[model samples]
Target: MSRPHVATIKEMAKFHTDSRYLEHLHKISQDGDNDDPQSGDFGLGYDCPVVEGIYDYATAVGGATLTAPQCLLDKRGEVAIDWSGGWHHPYHPVVGTGDLCGTGLGKGTSLWMTQGWVKVNLWMTQGWLGVDPMAGDPMCSFNMTPVRRAQCLQHALCHVLSCCVSVLSFHPVSLCWSY
Candidate 1:
């Protein structure tokens, strides 16, 4: 059987109206607040840890001794944990509108960065690298303005280059692709 394209609002509206769709909507709504670190993002949050755990478990079942924390790096760049789950809200020892900066990474101070806020952080963290998204840096991805998105994407792409410097020798004719 052929699989259908990804679902979208327009496509769903064209389908036969039925309670089945309504049921799915209801399921999503009920599970929406699951960003609660306590609840584990309605179970999707287990993806990282479970993948790591299984990979090692297969080799040993009980023979693998690696702890889940030591084995996996979640979006936060650390061991997967309930608290580290990106909530996109809640100020972590800092002031901001939401949690997890513009990059969607958790650590590095979680919070939503307004446009004006972005400008500020850029100014402050100019000398320092990796300022918190809440720092109001224009270069920081946390800033939600369209202009900042470009700037943030630029900075992120540049960082990507630096990160791959070691591997650059492997692929002499590298090509960059973006969406």
Candidate 2:
């Protein structure tokens, strides 16, 4: 089947509060950058569009609810995967609106304001499977060779697929692994 159309910036803003934050995101999506690490406008590299796609997919699958845990419970047999997620940060509406010279200003400090919040736990609470083939290995270190890291991820993903087959018990499944 054809993939669903990705969401626009306007659609994503609906899931968030804080007009300032929304404006920052809109600028990143449109003008390409606003220079604040704590704001969504900071990152608009070539991969920004891809990141937007991932967010759109997650929201479309009903993963943005405030009560995601309860929602999962209500749909016991259904399965959803958000492979590109797991950044584990909260959405702060007023993050970049305060004093410009404040301590830790512009250093991505606001990014941590929502750490460990409910939204960050969506995957864990909703029964999403996490597989780390590099578990117990340091292949993810920046000093590690790119080839080594790629190999590790590939092995891990293969292992994940095998585990899914066994755990799924012959049930049909749909998976999206966005990067």
Candidate 3:
């Protein structure tokens, strides 16, 4: 029997922040460690709201569920999503630093998915956080992925990092795969 279609959604949440979500910001400051002016150590844990919100949106749009470590692939059609696939510097919540610092995890994963077969549309933030586009060794987002044949198209939208750069790219199901 043929395997069922699967999709993945991944987001590189920002670090050096006071709190995870805006709602808890005030609460975190109230009783937690506000020592660091840059980023307070609020000993509280909250769900990554953006990531959760994206999952909800994907489900509503007909995307399949995915595990944190699993990769979603579409050999037939298109997928939809809100944010994810940016692959910047991030702590694994516990382990070593995750794909952050602009290492091109998005491109890496895309290459793994298409196995070098499809094209990629890269959507990035603007201004201080904006990607040089013309810079970066790979240059092309699609080419950044493991899939050599993958082509990349840059989509530098307004207010990208302000929300989630992943949101700019409309791909249902966060693709997760082994590096």
Winning candidate number (TM-score): 2
Off by over 4 Å in 3: 1-77, 83-89, 93-150, 153-179
Candidate 2 lDDT tens digits, 112-173: 32342322332322222222222332222244333454454344343221211111111111
What lDDT score belongs to each candidate, Candidate 1 first? 0.29, 0.34, 0.27
lDDT of 3: 0.27
RMSD of each: 17.6, 12.2, 14.2
Worst 10 residues of 1 by lDDT: 164-173
Q: Which candidate model has the greater lDDT, 1 or 2?
A: 2
Error of 2 at 88 (Å): 5.6
Off by over 4 Å in 1: 1-45, 51-111, 116-152, 155-179
How many clashing pairs in candidate 1? 12
Worst 10-residue lDDT window, candidate 3: 170-179
Higher-lDDT candidate among 1 and 3?
Answer: 1
